[model samples]
Target: MAGHYVIAGKKIPNHILSMGFIGAYAGAYALYALKPKPAQPATPPIQASSSDEEAFIKEFLAKAEAEESK
Candidate 1:
């Protein structure tokens, strides 16, 4: 049924070729299936003090501005 397209003047259907390819690949690996494994977040050794750092930065900026105004 298949001949050189240049000579046979016929184009093969995409679905037919795709199904044949899928069948070939699936038959080659019929017993096994592939699945993506879930990723786990790394555990941190220490927690950050967000509020404390924010307050310290604000207080430091205020002190710096007060000193500059003098």
Candidate 2:
């Protein structure tokens, strides 16, 4: 009664409890290892056109001029 576990007025054997714990541990690891990984989308490398670069440079210069006039 001191070290034994009683469930519903019945005593559970030590071997059964140890097996249940081992089974649960194995099951948890199995699920973790077998879980599906998320698919990552492949991204294309960005190539900036000359027109896009010119537009960006113009915008950046406009912002700098506005900040300087403030």
- For TM-score, the strongest prediction is 2
Q: Which stretches of candidate 2 lie over 4 Å from their true place?
A: 1-3, 42-70
lDDT of 1 by residue, 1-70 (tens): 4432232676766667778889999977864555555777764333437978767877777799899999
Question: What value does the lDDT take at residue 27 in candidate 2?
Answer: 100
Q: Count the backbone clashes (under 3 Å) in each candidate.
A: 0, 0
Per-residue lDDT of 11-46 in model 2, one digit per residue for the tens? 988778888999999999999999999977664434
**lDDT of each prediction vs. the true structure?**
0.69, 0.82
User: In candidate 2, which residue pairs clash?
Assistant: none
Q: Specify the highest-lDDT model's number.
A: 2
Model 2: per-residue Cα lDDT at residue 65:
88
Native-referenced Cα lDDT, model 1: 0.69
* lDDT, candidate 2, at 42: 63
Each prediction's TM-score versus the true structure: 0.31, 0.52
Runs in model 1 lying further than 4 Å from the true structure: 1-49
What's the TM for model 1? Answer: 0.31
